[model samples]
Target: MQITTEVVSGLERRLNVTVPAQRVKSQYDARLKRVAKTAKINGFRPGKVPLSRIQAEYGQGIQQDVINDLVRDTVFEAIEQEKIQAVGMPNIESVDVNDAGLTYKALVEVYPVVTVNSFDGLTVERQISTVNDADVDTMVDNLRKQRQSFAVKDGASADGDQVTFDFEGSIDGELFDGGAAKDFKLVLGSNKMIPGFEAGIVGMKAGEEKVIDVTFPADYQAENLAGKLAQFKINVSQVETAQLPEVDAQFLQLFGIDLAPNEGGIEKLKADVRKNMEREVKSSLRNQLKQQAFDAVLAANEIEVPKAMIAEETTRQRKLMLQQFAQQFGGAQQFDESMLPDELFRDKAERSVKLGVLISKVIADANLQVDQDRVKAMIAETAESYEDPSEVIEYYTNDKQQRAQVEAVVLEDQVVDHILAGAKVTEVTVDYQELLKRNQQQQG
Candidate 1:
């Protein structure tokens, strides 16, 4: 076998591999010989089929199979001999078969050589947060409000109140699409409607009738209604006041806490809420730190990323997004592919590929290994939230793939930690809500 390499621009390589004709003939003849033993025909008995008959019946197929196997084997051999760090699957450009040899060309992308700079002066800010009693109180109250009940009241609607009404919206004395609905129900402060629409519902009494004038914002989704003045003729049919459930025995029971058996059930529930909040705070903080670490590392280390890698990552991100949309859209068969273009994910894909390369390089340079203890801790933390956490832990412990997933996470965390240790780190104390808000605003 003979191999030649070509540089198809940055990170892309073309391998022109040629296998000697004798090798191809030998492989083909061997495969054909194996088939002649049990080759059956209309008249010949099994194991008694003639070689000429077998050759006539299976010559093309055997030759094709041999070529396929030889192509794969010789390509890998060429890659190994050339010491190429190929990325994704190589593309077979052309294959030729003749008396001289079996010649084939493969297009492959190699991993770029990346060098990570020292993190001695790199600045990374780590957020420090803790769940306070007030935060716990707010969380419990929000949970109660989520399960809140409402009753029809003989009064005007107010914020947190639900009102059912009939409304007909018109723009300049002309109705438009989606301009009218009968017996529509809305929460007075839900912001489900345009800015002024919900505000107009406030202080509306049951069985009342009124006309509300609202101006659509310039950025309204509907082009025709954007920045236009509209009037809604509303007939209020019912007004219901929101009532949050008390944090008593029944309310505690909703959270799987039986207050009858426990004397301090409410307090215990508060502790549980605080524990969950603490877990959230820890996870969020770690995510923020990891993101910062990744950004710092990427910025400090400059490397030209492989376009093929970015394309692969982009394809992966697109697939994941489509899966999410499928779940969201009620399993609609056949999606409109045009809705999500490659450009939408190109930036993220490039960033991801760059970070992955940088991280892998650091792992190699530092000779970092996955911490089994950290993996166990991470798995335990994940199982903490599930009922029968022992079973959850057992599942992860028994499943190699699942545990390997956890191990990967731990290894990544270790990489970030190693970078943070070498970098100039500053701790920033932020309000619990403010930290969460910042985390939510951050893009991957």
Candidate 2:
């Protein structure tokens, strides 16, 4: 057997292997000997069949089987011996088996050679948002609304009030699909209805009739309804105003905030709200900084990624996404598999694969390793957070795959920290209200 390899690309290789004719013949002869021992043919007892007859009967099949096994075994051994960090699987494209030497060729996708320098100098800017008095007051008001009660007001509807209405919708003078509803409740300032629809209802009094015309957004979720102009004939049933809950001990108790009956529960709740808001603000800032670090690294480094790995990762991502979609859409029974296009997700899948490769490479280049102590601590912390702490710990310890997954995350964090250490970091103060507004915009 002879083996040779050629570099097909930066992270790909082609292995060419040849088995000499003599070697093939020797193996065939050895297999024939084994066959003779158990030979069962007409007019011939076991172990007594002629070699020529056996060859004539089953020679091609045995030879083909032997060649297949030999090729598979040799290719794997050769790859291992070459010390290549192959990902996914090798694709065999050419194989020739005959009385002469057997020749086979396969393409292998391997890990890219990665190098890193000046990773410690990565500079990232973080928005340091602080919760101020205004943020605290706003949070308290939101909490009050959360516990608010509604009372019917026999008057015209106004902003910051709820209105109950029965409406018939029409498209081009004809009743349209999903166009009619009875006793729909909408808040005037919530913007729950389409643009201008809620505004059109604000000045109308109870028991009054009105027509609200609004156009659907171009990118509306329902394709058939996108950009469609429709008139809703509505009857205002009743108007109600929200009555906010008092900021007393009872109100504070709703949030597990303990305070004396006559104490300043309002101020205490405000402080608590500010603390929570600051935590969330910092979390968002950290994520932004991490993203910046990733971009900086990608911009400074160039490495060849294996196509085989990308294809494998793409499949994995698609499977995960499809499973999540199915779960959210109720179940497999309700899922229309054809509704999702492979083209729609392919680009995102590829990017995820590329990022994974980059992360792995960065970890290797930076000598980042997951400390066993840290992994154990993380497991212990997670277990402590659960009611059945011991059971959770036992589950993780007993499951090798789960433990390995956790360990991988720890390793990735180490890599992130490594990059962060060398990167330039600047912290700037930001208002909590501004952060909240950005969050709202992102959700919208």
Candidate 3:
């Protein structure tokens, strides 16, 4: 066997492999002998079929099988000999497999050679948030309001009030689809309806009929309805005003808690609120730090990323997202491929692929290995949260791929931790109110 490789690009190569015809003939003959031994014909006794007949019957099938096997075997050998790390599966059709001194060529995309410059002294300010008594008090008040009651009213609908109404909407005097509802309950200040819809409903009194005109959002999901104007003939059914419950013993009891259960009910609530708030703050900090780390690595490394890796990642991301979207739309429904374009997530996919390559390089450079015990501990931790912990653990154990995914996550987390150790993360102290404002701004 003789192998030759030509670099197509930075990460792509064309491999031309030539196998001796004598080798192919020898294997073909050996396969025919094996088949003859197991062959059973009408006249020939079992395990005594003639070689000529066996060859004539199965020669093409045997040749194809042998070609496939040799291609796979030699492809790996070529990769190993050339010291190439492939991105995904090679383009098999690009390979030309034939007989007379068997000649085959395969087009393969290999992983890029990544070089990390530095992660040290990379200054990134992590906004620190605190949960104080005031924040906790606000949280408790909000919780109390969630347990509020509504009083029936004969007055007109107002902000913060609930309204029940029947509405028929039409586009240019012709009723458009999904624009009509019977006795639909809507909250005035919830912002659930299109921009002007809720505002128009706000001043409507019970039993009053009015026509409300509104335009659909320019980027509405339904292409046919985007930026279309519609008039709704609405009849208000009822109006109601909310009455928040007082944060006292009765309200506390509603929360499955008795004041005597803790030294101070308000203080206990404050502690719980603080713990939850701290978790959110930590999560935000982690996300910010990771993004900074990723940006730092990308900026530092000037290596040309493999296009094949990005394309593969893009394909995987699309498939995973489409599967999720299909499940959400309806079970067993065929996904509309036209909805998701390659341009939609091409940049993100490329960034993700590059980040993955950078991380893997760092891990290899540091000689980092996945800790088996840590993976098991993570599995246990995951199962501990479930009611049937043993069953969850057993399920994970049985699913090799799922278990490996979990292990990869654990390993990645370790890598992030290692990067954080070297990263210059500057702590920014912020009050609870200020942090809350910042968070709200970020979300906005």
99-191 in candidate 1: lDDT tens per residue? 778999999989898878999979999989988999999999999989999999997889999999999999989988898998898988777
lDDT-better candidate, 1 vs 3: 1
Angstrom error at residue 222, model 1: 6.2
Overall lDDT per candidate, in order of appearance: 0.90, 0.79, 0.79
Local accuracy of candidate 3 as per-residue lDDT tens digits, 1-444:
787889988778888778788877777788778878887778989777777778788878988877787777777887788777776777765445456666777788877777787678566566666676778788887787687778889877899898989999999999878989998988788888888999998888999999989999999888988999989999998999988887677876665556885547766656756776776776566666667666777777767677777787888888888888878887535766567888987999988887888898999998989988888887886776466999998988789998999889778767777777887877778787776676677775
Runs in model 3 lying further than 4 Å from the true structure: 40-43, 46-49, 93-100, 119-123, 254-256, 299-304, 311-345, 366-444
- Compute each candidate's TM-score over C-alphas: 0.82, 0.79, 0.80
How much lDDT does candidate 1 score? 0.90
lDDT of 3: 0.79
TM-score, candidate 1, is 0.82
- After TM-score superposition, the amount by which residue 42's alpha carbon in candidate 2 deviates from its true location, in angstroms, is 8.1
Q: Once model 1 is optimally superposed onto the true structure by TM-score, how far is the C-alpha of residue 193 displaced, in angstroms?
A: 3.2
lDDT of 1 at 119: 94
Of the pair 1 and 2, which is ahead by TM-score? Answer: 1
Tell me the TM-score of model 3: 0.80
The number of the candidate with the highest TM-score is 1
